[model samples]
Target: MTEQQETPPTGVSKALQKDIPQATVARLATYLRVLAVLADEAVAIVSSEELAVAAGVGSAKLRKDLSFLGPNGVRGVGYDVIKLRDRIEDVLGLSEGHRVVLVGAGHLGRALVGYGGFRRRGFAMVGLFDNDPAVIGTSVTGLIVRDVAELTDAVAALEPTIAVITVPDAAAQGVCDLLVAAGLQCVLSFSALALEAPATVEVRRVDLAVEMQLLSFERARNAESAAEEAMSAAAGALLPRVSMTTSKGAVVQP
Candidate 1:
């Protein structure tokens, strides 16, 4: 009998792998965005520590995260900025363009239509829709705003796979229903209202107020950190100019 050789486990080789976590993949996308910014700044190479800081993660965590995708980095030289960026773009399906339609054409809708981030990230804004006749036929971000009544027709013509709903909470469900009927597979909803859709369609909600609150929390944390640093500086200045050992065995130098 001939001896059989076992195949080595390749990390994240297949799309349907059960081991890789969705959260990790999403973080990888974020890391890719940060890497793009670094590349734009002409950063040639980045250590795991530097990349983690750019991605708002710890070095160890970033290393473990990238390890799941395979050996994508060098030991002493760290990761090549452009190569890692391309690899991540390929992994996140951002290499190909995704067509998107904006519904509502209100403040948030217009902002999203004009958002540079979407364009930079490979999402193409195909069209905009609004119920108001005045806003209809107007151009926002080089795309003509069309009537909501022609939503189905516009979607069919554009073949938009993703729809962004920025309509009023009262009208969100209706807009979502229309989007579903128009054959949209994914929706990035910015409305406050929760919507019910078919099992096949995916909806991601982005609440402005919730985001504002999170930002406020971050500001508070930063303020607290600043206050602590100031107090430490003041305490250091007040102490005698000498090296001292505290009762707790911590060495303090002034």
Candidate 2:
């Protein structure tokens, strides 16, 4: 959604993509998110360079990534923000709203239900389910929690294309089994454990703890790096900050 800054100097032929690489496909999702933000901010045309910067990718790589969408952006004038966004939507199958159902009303489940991101991204949370009697009739984020035993029936009736699993590790497989049989083709699993689904079904696992641990590792690396830099600086400070070179320079410290 960002405005175009500068035009490309050379004329270019229309780019083509027979099949997008998985890496590029992954990056396109990120691009879509950035485009949405830019569109919300009222950005119109965005040069490849600008979009790349915003998306944390190289300009050439971003341009190549977008080429998979086919002739969406003009080489010189840049891309029309809305047009590019729509193209990505078409590619991602987000042009149509996808119905979703939540399984498990645990803490993580409750959070996913309340999250507005799915709705914002053309995914609608149509139903909520949990097994516990205490939570069965309770409402989280305006949807009444139905008993998990009703999942198969609920899926048949609700016809949700996406099923979200936030149950504990012990229950994830059971929940997954129900979802596959209930005719849901896609699942978003938040449990720490991996759930095995049929080859026909697609399951996207999101382990929050693993992600946090990765961040922790990164932080530790950065701290170690900083400590190394500080030690180097402290050692350097013990020596001369500047040095002078005579006519026949001995590289003498001034």
For every candidate, C-alpha RMSD to the true structure in Å: 8.4, 10.9
Best by lDDT: 1
Scored by lDDT, model 2 comes in at: 0.78
lDDT of 1 by residue, 79-194 (tens): 99987887676666666779999999988888888899998988999989999989999999798989999999988899987899988889999999999998998999988888
**lDDT score for residue 149 of model 2:** 86
> How do the predictions measure up, each by TM-score?
0.77, 0.78
lDDT computed for candidate 1: 0.79
Clashing pairs in 1: none
lDDT of each: 0.79, 0.78
Off by over 4 Å in 1: 1-23, 215-254
